[model samples]
Target: MKKVLVVILVAFIILQFFPIDKTNPAPTPGMDFLTIKKTPPETAEMIRTSCYDCHSNETAYPWYSNFAPASWFLKNHINEGRKHLNFSTFATYEPKRQLHKLEECIEMVGKKEMPLESYFVGHQDAKLTDEQRKLLIDYFKREKAETERKMSF
Candidate 1:
């Protein structure tokens, strides 16, 4: 038992050396979803607080992100999120893609699949209330409709 404990401690210490990269891509305000869509302040703040950490280029790594194994998991999750929908570069997506992304947003939020449960473990502030969830779903639905309408023209 003592030997096992010591090994675990040593492994943890070694893992600390392999810190995750915390660099965020440079901000592109002109291409950002919030800016281009002219999202209301309240809605924009909610989106930023609840989604931007993983979904946008403005990731603000928490203190624990300096640690290793957990940091690795976090980095991978963030990369996947950005790949699926990078609001920071939303304006660059073609109109069809933009509409699809907005549809995905509505579906995800409406189904309560977003703001992943594990995320609230570290960021309680990101947790959405029932009202907030409804607000976000409504906002996404509106955005999707607007995108579709514009594409028709």
Candidate 2:
């Protein structure tokens, strides 16, 4: 039993050597939501503080992400967040897709479902207040309207 325990510990140590990819890609010019939309400074700041880490190409990886299993989990979250809605690549999407994304953004904000709890754990700044939630929902709703208008033309 002691020998089996030793092997398990060794295996766990070996796993630590294999690190996960935690790369943050560079932002594309004029393709990001902030660049394409005339977002208010306050709104933009809030979004950056709360949502950018997972949803944009400008992730500021925390020191804890350097470890093995934690880094793997974080990378998975980043990939999933980007897959759902990448603000950095928002403008590159089709007009219809942009509109749909904006709608989803508004819905998610209104539901207080964004900036997932795990993300908010280490990032207290990412936790939205009632007003911040309203702010995001309102902004996304307005953007959705603008997208619809543009698509109609």
Each candidate's lDDT (Cα)?
A: 0.94, 0.87
Q: Which run of 10 residues does model 1 get worst, by summed lDDT?
A: 61-70
Off by over 4 Å in 2: 1-8
Quote each prediction's TM-score: 0.97, 0.92
Tell me how far the alpha carbon of residue 139 in candidate 1 is from the true structure, in angstroms, after superposition: 1.1
RMSD of 2: 1.6
Residue 76 lDDT in model 1? 99
Best by TM-score: 1
Q: Go through the candidates in order and give the C-alpha RMSD of each one to the true structure.
A: 0.8, 1.6
**Prediction 1 TM-score vs. true:** 0.97
Q: Residues 1-153, candidate 2, lDDT per residue (tens digit)?
A: 999999988987887898987667876959989878978899999999998898899989998788777888888888888898899998889998998888888888788888787787799989999988988898888888888898888
Model 1 local distance difference test score: 0.94
